[model samples]
Target chain A: MTQEYQDGNALAGPLAELFAVDVTAATGRCVSCGDTRRVADLRVYGHALGWVARCPSCEHVMLRLVRAPDAAWIDLQGTLSLRVPLPPA
Target chain B: MGIVSPGFRRRRRDDDVQLPPGQYLTEDFPVLSAGPTPNIPLDRWEFVIASETGQEYRWTWDELQELPAEEPTVDIHCVTKWSKLGTSWRGVSLDLLMEDVETTADYALAHSYGGYTTNLPLEDLLDGKAWIVYEYEGSELAPQHGGPARLLVPHLYFWKSAKWVRGLQLQEFDELGFWESVGYHDYGDPWREQRYAGD
Candidate 1:
């Protein structure tokens, strides 16, 4: 397959259902490859199931969001660390 | 439940068309891929069924056209939760494709053109549960929709159907494919709601 993934910005609406903060701007490290980058910079793959964000360098899944009838499953098990940006007071 | 969406314009509209668990009917077919879609020219296109002994049964685009074709109207459920009901397709049945081959393998890992793969029990690909479909909705299947041909195992989740399919390797081991190796379920059954590894 070619490198035809959507930008992490495409993840804003879906991730919004789970987090108040805009997670797309959050920087995180991919556990598989140790590449750190903003969530908005990741390569996102959208399917009928939901959005799967992969590490841009390693192509490993860093996050996946699949929703069921009454539950939403946001799996970030592939992440090592996440640093969400906050506003200065 | 009524299949409701905000101005969905896909295709068929069947009111009260009962859907599988957690699925919403879509009128238009949505195209989603993990990477780029391969464009295989008709001359270079080929389909192979690799037996456990390394025998590759191949069919060229022209030969495939010679095979008896069947038009199947079936419902498809995507892992993303969209269900398309009564979709029409034309293809050769797996039963016919396997008639000449002797295979005792227990599992199949369908390989696609663009490095995509999906595993299934060999039995799941046989007995008329699957096909090598090249046409959808009475027209030549589009590359975006897995042409020149793709595996059609509609019973399992659509991912298990394997888009841009090129070959089916028969082996004794249950080797996981692209999605299966990820967090996606090994045997994706949409009705059972098996979408992830634990589910």
Candidate 2:
């Protein structure tokens, strides 16, 4: 267990398949511990369950994504708020 | 179609046996943590086994070291499709830890130092099925890898072996943990490819 796995930034590729903007760079606050951090900094665990992003402060799951053949389920209950940056005009 | 990145290829050992479906072999052990590594002093660390009715059993670091320890070599499969074969660890067996505890609970929730939790069937933890591992690969388990001590349940996916484990709370009924309540399966079986809720 010496190797460090990918961070939340690894979610950008999969998230881009759904949203127009890059979600990995977004900022969010953990609902459980109230710690704010970039989505990219959240610990990302990829498994058969899909992508799970957890708060680095409290270990509370901030997001869960499960993409099926025709649909996708995104759960963000652990996140109090998500701020997605917009492209500069 | 997905493009294969340059210099990336699945590594395999010639002696490798059958790997579970959808898994690749890896010689390197990956550290996956939901939170920052917790810094707990040995004197301040204790392993607790508590029943739902509030009967508690506690073991200090030194006390744990005095118990019988086993060094088992087993193959561990992570939920992320990485399997490391023939890994060795030294720890006290759950059987020894639960020897005196009288309980009818069928489920146990492992609580960790970083507030991480994972639930498992009581059967999955007994009968030499698991251990509270403090040494890995001839060295004290690293904090990043869930030391002062971590639960080692090799039969299930790595997630079930909660890192930085602090205690086990026996429950009468099944209750989901951090991942189980989310999208991950309640009983994560790597062999069955049970990674999601419906799988």
Using TM-score as the measure, which candidate wins? 2
* Per-residue alpha-carbon lDDT of candidate 2 for residues A1-89, written as tens digits (9 for 90 to 100): 44334689889888999898888888999999999999999888663346778888877878887765555668899899999899788
Total clashing residue pairs per candidate? 7, 0
What is the fnat score of candidate 1? 0.42
Stretches of model 2 off by over 4 angstroms after superposition: A1-11, A18-29, A33-61, A66-73, A82-89, B1-16
> Tens digit of lDDT per residue, candidate 1, span A7-85?
8999999889889999998999999999999999998888535677888897777887765555666778789999999
Cand. 2 TM to true fold = 0.79
Every model's TM-score on chain B: 0.91, 0.92
Q: How does each model score on TM-score?
A: 0.73, 0.79
What's the distance in Å from true for residue B44, model 1? 0.9
> Fraction of the real A/B interface contacts present in each candidate?
0.42, 0.09
Query: What does TM-score give for chain A of every model?
Result: 0.89, 0.89
* Model 1 alpha-carbon miss at residue A11, Å: 6.3
What residue pairs are clashing in model 2?
Answer: none
Candidates in order, interface RMSD in Å: 3.5, 4.0
Judging by lDDT against the true structure, name the best candidate: 2
Q: Which ten residues in a row have the lowest lDDT in candidate 2 chain B?
A: B7-16
